[model samples]
Target: MKNLKVNPSNSLKTSRLVIRIFASLITLFYLIAFVPKLIQMLLGDAPERPPGADWEGSMVTVSFLIFILGYIVTWWRGLVGGIIIAIGSILMFLTHMMSASGEFEFLPFFVFSGPMLLCGILYLVFWWKKP
Candidate 1:
């Protein structure tokens, strides 16, 4: 019987493509949904806050901007982008908790950041495994 050979590199390449596509899609979605609003916020056009929400809002905005920067950077530098995305994800959660105060909502935070976190980890893994 002839021996059938399996190429590990092909599988690795496939995984890399999969992760890249997922990351790209996530980035695209966020960019489309928020980029315009983010621009407005950054340009000092954001709607007025109630009273003491400025700090919390700024924290949340900065965290999201960090995540977006990571998304843009991932195309060029996977490892660095991954680190940034991970940091941003945690910051998003923490800032959210700070704003919530008494009633903490875990589901919303996880739902928003979980996919980004997963992609960041995958990016780091692929970068480390690269030959």
Candidate 2:
């Protein structure tokens, strides 16, 4: 077997590619997750709204829009997009954590937060060193 040398630029490109893909995936996941709820609400199939439901729903809608915008920017403006995604991911992770009780389940938190955080960090690192 022959030893292979890795080029730093090539590695960086690879990392950026991975980050872009991850961002896209996260955006897709959010779309998939939210569209059903959105349709349900529109169709009046959602459960009865509690107090402050409108405010909560509005916030969620805004956040999802922001996430989509961040994802689109990630392909062009890495650092800014990364910060947006990272902040969103952190908020989501914290929300899941706060909602869990003694019988906590890790899957929900991990599913929502893991890829966003990982790719966001990678994008930040790569973009930070670009210039």
Expressed as tens digits, the lDDT of each residue in 10-129 for candidate 2 is 888887787677677777888888787777877888786622266544544555566677677787788898888778777656655555264445896577667767777887899987
Candidate models: Cα lDDT each? 0.78, 0.71
Q: Which stretches of candidate 2 lie over 4 Å from their true place?
A: 1-5, 47-63, 100-104
lDDT of 1 at 43: 82
Best by lDDT: 1
Error of 1 at 104 (Å): 2.6
Candidate 2 residue-wise lDDT at 66: 61
Query: Please, what are the lDDT tens digits per residue for candidate 1 over residues 1-131?
Result: 99998787887889889998998787787678666766666787867553225787677667778888987898899899999988888887777677747566887586657777888899899889886
